[model samples]
Target: MKGRAIAGIALILLGAYLFFMRDENISTGSVFAYFWPTLFVIPVGILLHWLYFGVFGRSAVGVLVPAGIVTTTGIVCQIATLTDGWSYLWPGFILAVAVGLFELYWFSGRNKALLIPINILAGASLIFFVAFSISNLLGKLALGQPFLAIVFILAGAFLLAARKSTP
Candidate 1:
């Protein structure tokens, strides 16, 4: 019953959107514009991986995870587009990357190098992204100065200003 209700609601909304927003200018290609990201998940992803595998074979198995992850990030970007949710959903891409790293680590015989970065990225995304999107952190960050950028600039400047200590 609940599922039917949700489906009904979706149908109604789609109907209203068609009635109010539809135009003769709308073509199949234009309709598919919103879903362009799916292309990356399919033809681009499959074709590139196929080509890579053809050239490198299992020796390049590690490429699979990151390629799949590019698709995942594209998927996340697609979702964010529908409602302009990038402000909150950007972390989701980071989380997706961490997930891809875990896949690599798992499938590539558990490389110790992947474990540290995976844990760090997953932890940072959970802590920072969740806090920014769900809690008071969003308000503060939005309202506050661009301190993060400033800090980055300052760090770069400091590096440039420093004298070489190597003797």
Candidate 2:
């Protein structure tokens, strides 16, 4: 537990430093300049946890490390987005849903009830995201724009509910 706490604190400090550092103004665009390599820590943390679990069979620390890393990454991203004027919400939300679905598929037991709700929520969120993107792109369509979003949301909900009710 102490090790996990230390790792968590380290991740937070590293993220804070990365986000708060002074930006160097330059015209030449470099790949490293556009992307922060430190973000890879999240996946590296997940991999470390997986390896530990595989070797030791099972341990609470194994879970804590990965969860801590992901949570820290999310916090950093959220803070950076809000403070730095970066649009992180959409991508963050999508990544979170994808991760949740992957976890459900990989780790969950065969329980139809739990799976159905998760699928429905995932489907709805995906459809809403798509609708939002489309609406933004079709700004000139100027005819019942909000209605289109509502239609998409309703369609997604109906399809998910129907699938759930079906065999």
Candidate 3:
């Protein structure tokens, strides 16, 4: 029964692919671009989860490492694709590895040793993401004397004026 189901699914997928490709106006690239997350990443993540939970049980928590990786990659790519933010968002790839390591640390008996690399990788990924994204967000905040002067003046004025007034 399982083999039959698998064969049926494959047949359906192949038929769908051929049916879609039959259209001359539709380029395969456009048709398949969004298919990767569904066809590969999602299935791979689910399979990893199934292995850990359904098949091997808690003893195989290590499978979550790859599951985390694939899931993160899919999320990052989906966000990038939707928002057209491929530029600074590339730091997510580094963050993805960190996430996988963190999952391994969390699930695999909470090994204290893994904390070091997990913290380092996650910290570095965040730092890079912040640094890279700031350039796009504030344009370096127009780092000039005028900007600093305004900020300082505002802070000083606000502090002095907002202080409690004696009756």
Candidate 4:
């Protein structure tokens, strides 16, 4: 891409970001301010790439990386903004990685090797998020026998999901 085109695109995106931020009343000085604009740029980038490649007759699975990362970052930022800290939102990154891997596996001709790690990341993210939520809500209750049983059940469910997703 030419420098002028890139600059124009950047300016347009910046304008849109500023407009939305103002419209939504989201603080520009918030802790997540730095990452918020990415939610806009990343999706636009993905769509532009797809239009240039996919609609033009070619497409690649690599597009999913940015798509997943941006999505995960947006989710994490929103959650963190609400929670007032990073806290339990870190699992979002794992889920994003799993999303990327799953997209690759699905779009890149079902490469079997990607399935294992995708499942692992997805399962671990789910399990971690659940544990974090339970622990925060139940505290001592979360550490008792019932908690373990719930974890076991969730783990089994994760395994089953993995099995189902696999070819």
- Per-candidate Cα lDDT values, in order, are 0.68, 0.53, 0.76, 0.66
Root-mean-square deviation of every model: 11.4, 11.8, 7.6, 10.9
Show the lowest summed lDDT stretch of 10 residues, model 1.
34-43
Tens-digit lDDT string for candidate 3 (43-114)? 787788788879998888778888888888877875565446777788888888888888888777789988
Over the stretch 22-135, how does candidate 1's per-residue lDDT look in tens digits? Answer: 563656675455446654454565554665468876677677677666766776766665545677778877787887788678757788999998899889888877766754
Candidates in order, TM-scores: namely 0.55, 0.40, 0.63, 0.54
User: Model 3, 58: alpha-carbon shift in Å?
Assistant: 2.3
Residue 129 CA error for candidate 2 (Å)?
1.4
Q: How close is candidate 4 to the true structure, as a TM-score?
A: 0.54
In model 4, state the lDDT of residue 62. Answer: 71
Candidate 3 wrong stretches, greater than 4 Å: 1-31, 139-167
Sorted by lDDT, highest first, which candidate order results? 3, 1, 4, 2
Candidate whose lDDT is highest? 3
Clashes of 1: 0
Pick the winner on TM-score between candidates 1 and 2.
1
**Residue 96's lDDT in candidate 2:** 52
Model 2 RMSD, rounded to 1 decimal: 11.8
RMSD in angstroms between candidate 1 and the native structure over all alpha carbons: 11.4
Clashing pairs in 1: none
Cα error, candidate 3, residue 160 (Å): 20
